[model samples]
Target: MPRIGVLIDNNTLDDHLAREHGLSLVILLDSGDRWLWDTGQSGIFFDNARAMGIDLAQLSGLALSHGHYDHTGGLDRLWRETDFTGPIYGHPAVMTGRYACSCCSPPRAIGLRTVNRQRLASQLIPVSDTARLGPGLTMVTNITRQAGNFEPIQGFYLDPLGRTTDTIPDDTALVLETGYGPVLILGCCHSGLENTCDHIAVNLGINRFHALIGGLHLKSAKPNHIEETLQTITRFGFSEVYAGHCTGTHAISSLSDALPGKIHPMGSGLLLTFPPSGHSTT
Candidate 1:
């Protein structure tokens, strides 16, 4: 069996826990393998983890989904606090400068901090292709763009001046082979969920996904874009979906209306358990 715990998120299960505009997940496998996926925008992850009684030093590995500051900001704190010496998996571009400029706000640095990059230099494992973490877990890198309708956010740039377009190629997902099917653990889904699913189907021969947990990065999407994304998600037929972080309230509501009980609102302190093969819930 495998269990997932929401260590940090934009919302909290209760008022006592602190909330943040970021995401982080802790995965515990039946074999005692523990993996930390992404670290939230600040030390809030550690705060929430302490409240939840999760020990950061027990992590067997660390994985970053993209270069966004919201995803990798806690790296400095993690390094300073935890004694875990495991490899940190991510794309090479994750440490590069990234910015976001919208009509509403000025260009802001949204990439990983240099200090954290230096701290994680020795343990960083840049994966250009699919990298196997364990027997049933794999890190997907450089997801190909297969869905033409899905577009990256318009205001992102690779340069501080917001001149060079940032495709966010480093956005990745972790796939876990479960008894039911493949479960996708995403950071922000900047490459588009449809594209990520297609890449997995084509490269890994996985057609159905049992569950999808993490941000979709659709907070500022247009109505048509949201509709198209929802339609594509419906076509894939995921059994369970816990979406939050960059997934706006409107989109989450729409998904809940469309999928009924299949959709769940993800937040800090939430936990999900999946039993091993042939193990009944009863």
Candidate 2:
């Protein structure tokens, strides 16, 4: 198993810590294998990485959890700053036109960040089903719907315009396999946490996961959804859970109470080491 390190660079919180938009994560694997899960909204990315001591230029590639601005905003800086010749991964819709809606109101076409899009195509290695990133490293492509009361991720709406239809399927995630066990990483998890877990379990043909890092997409989850999610997670029996991003504070607290020590706080500059022996100063 290899060591996995994650940095939550962007978020939905405002200046006073209020929810608004979202972002992605920067995950680093052992053997100097590095990846950007999602770039984040823009201004804060590079600085955030520096503050966290993450060198994006050294990253092997950049991955988009989805096509939202908050997730892809940092691509411009990355393309401008580094000679990084690594592949970026994501669904094709990430480059296509999309929209953001408000209370089922008129659709506001999501403004395309052309520069970033171009950089992604030139640099990205778009994946659909599944692909081996590096040794023992794989990205999941199967999307499934499990029988349970847990609600899927919500509030994401697409518009059915001229050539575009409401297509949010571009939402995806990343999974890393370590020496200890497989660690599931997510961006927004617009798919579903259970789906993500189940897919990984089936694809890898292994049930036990050492840890689950990244967003569980529980911020908007209903009570039943939360309860079912917790139950499902308990069944998987992950040793540690480092979650945040789209996961609300209230939900995190509740999960913390339910699981006690198993829950770990995830933020912009947090590092988690594997084998339970690597020293983490932060």
Cα-based TM-score, every candidate: 0.94, 0.83
The 10 consecutive residues of candidate 2 with the worst lDDT sum are 11-20
**What do the candidate models score in CA lDDT, each in turn?**
0.83, 0.64
Q: Write the residue-wise lDDT of candidate 2 on 1-282 in tens digits.
A: 255444333342223222224455665655567767776666356666676567777887777777777677667777778856788777766776667655657666553454755556787677777776765556765356566534343434455343344436676766576656667777766667777777766766757777887777787777777787687679888888877776788778888889999898666556666553232111
Q: In candidate 1, residue 97 scores what lDDT?
A: 84
Q: Could you tell me how far off, in angstroms, the CA of residue 146 lies in candidate 2 after the best superposition?
A: 3.6
Once superposed on the true structure, which residue ranges of model 1 sit more than 4 Å away at CA?
A: 277-282
> Per-residue lDDT of 1-282 in model 1, one digit per residue for the tens?
888889989998868787898889988877788888989998688888888888888888898998888888888888788855789998988887889987778889888854845658788999998887755778998899864667555789987677899999998999887778677898989888888888888888777778899998788787777887787677777989999999889889888897899888789999888765432111
Number of the predicted model whose TM-score against the real structure is largest = 1
Q: Report the alpha-carbon TM-score of model 1 versus the true structure.
A: 0.94
Kindly give the stretch of ten consecutive residues in candidate 1 with the minimal lDDT sum. Answer: 273-282
Q: Best lDDT goes to which candidate?
A: 1
Q: How far does residue 206 in candidate 1 sit from its true spot (Å)?
A: 0.8
